[model samples]
Target: MLFNLSRPPTALRRSTSEFLQLCRQLPSARRALYVTSRSKTMSEPKVISVEGLSSSEANVSGSLRNAPRVHPPALMASVAILALLRSESNKFPPSTIIIEQYRPPVDRHVVGLISEGESPEQTAIRELEEETGFKASGVVQSSPLLVSDPGMTNANMKLVTVDVPFPENLEMPAQKLDPGEFIQVRIVELAKLRAELQAYERKGFVIDAKLDHLASGFELAEKLRQPKSST
Candidate 1:
C-alpha cells in the first residue's frame, strides 16, 4: 500500500534535550514509534514503549495478538531491470550487452519505483525505455521482491531481465530521461562486468547493491563453467 509521510502530533513532540532526558529515565530497550493507520489521516500513531520487554519481544508480531508493530503507510519498492542485448558482431563466443548508467550518488541499473496501478513488469519496461530509450515488448524474467536492506528499511525491489536486440550497426541509443535525470549510459561487456564494477568503485562511485550482486553472479557462473584441474 502507498503511504504519505506526515508530521507527528504536537503531544508526541519532544525537544532534543527532553528526548535525551527521557532516554536516561528509561532503563530498558530504546523507545520506538510505530506508525499505524488509525484513521483516514493516519494521525493515531502508537508509541511502543518496550521498557520491560526483552529485545526480541520488542518487535511485535501477530503471535502477540495485542502487540503493536510499526507498519509504514507505504512500502519502498521498485523494479530493477538487467537489460541484455545480443550483439551480432560476436555471435561466436556470445556477448551480452548490459545497459548501465551513472548518476549522482551512485551507479545503478535501469530502475524505477512502481507506480500505483502498474505491475512490476510494466515498471521494468517503462524504466528501460525512459532511462535508455530501449523498448521491450515484455520482460524475459521477473523475480520476486528482493529486500535491499531489511535492517535499515523496508525497501525492496523486483529484479527483472529484459532481452532486446542490439542494433546491428552498433549505434548508441538515446535516452529519454525525465528532467533532472542526468544519467550517463554505459554499455558494459558481460564478460567484464565484474571488472567494470571494481573499476567504478575505484573511481569513488557508490555501486548499487543490485548491480553489484548481478556482476558477482556472472563471475560465479564463469568460475563454475571452468573445468577443474586433474588431481
Candidate 2:
C-alpha cells in the first residue's frame, strides 16, 4: 500500500497543493489535516508539498477525485446456495458445505464463481450440485445482491436458498467437485447451526463470514421467539 513519490506523479503533486491551500484557509486547519490523514492511513505526510504549484493544477484537480462508482468484474462475481434438505420427518435441515481447501485457511459455504454467460440462479444450482451433490428443485428464496468487504474489494455475490428432497434410501450423493476442490457436506439442524460453527472455531477452523452471519441470525431469531422469564 506504500506509494513511492520521490518525483511525485502529476495528480498527486497537484492534489497536495490544492489540499494545502484549503488547509491554510482556516486557522489550525493544516495541523488538524496533517494529524488526521497521516496518523490514520499514512506513515508520513512529508512527501506532500505545496511549495511550487502552477495555476493549471486547478484544472486537473477535478480528475483526481475518486470515481463516482465502480462495477465489479463479471468473472469475479459469484453465487452462494443455502441448500435445505427436506426429510420425511418434516424436519428441513440445512446442509453446510465445509470447504477444506488450500487457499482460504478456513471453511466456507456452497459458493461458486459465476462462469461466463451464466445467470446467478444457474450458478447457484450448479454450485449446489457440484459442491454438495444435491440438486436444487427450485430456488426457495433469493437475497438482495450482496458485496463482501466493500472497503477492500468490489466483488459481489448472490445468495439463494433451495430445497433438496431427501432420497428414499437416505444415502447422500457423491460430490462432483472441480479439479483440486476438497469439500465436506454436513446436514445440520437449524437450531444447532450456531453451535456447530462455534465448535468448528474451537477446533482451529475459522468459519466464513457470510456463513457465520447466517448462523448468528438464526440464533438471534430463536432467542427472540422465546418467552421472557418473569423478574
RMSD each, Å: 13.7, 17.8
Candidate 2: minimum summed lDDT over ten consecutive residues — where? 1-10
TM-score of each prediction: 0.62, 0.62
Q: State each candidate's clash count.
A: 0, 0
Which stretches of candidate 2 lie above 4 Å from their native place? 1-71, 74-76, 91-97, 104-110, 167-170
- TM-score: model 2 vs. ground truth: 0.62
Candidate lDDT values, in order: 0.55, 0.55
The residue ranges of model 1 lying beyond 4 angstroms of the native Cα positions read 1-54, 57-76, 88-110
Q: For candidate 2, lDDT tens digit of each residue in 81-114?
A: 7776666655454444444322321123337667
Model 1 lDDT tens row, 1-231: 011111232235465466546645653222222112222333543421112223345575332122222442253366767777665664433333443232222223346667788888888888877876777756688787677655444546777787766446444668897643444456667788778768766754556665676778889999999999999
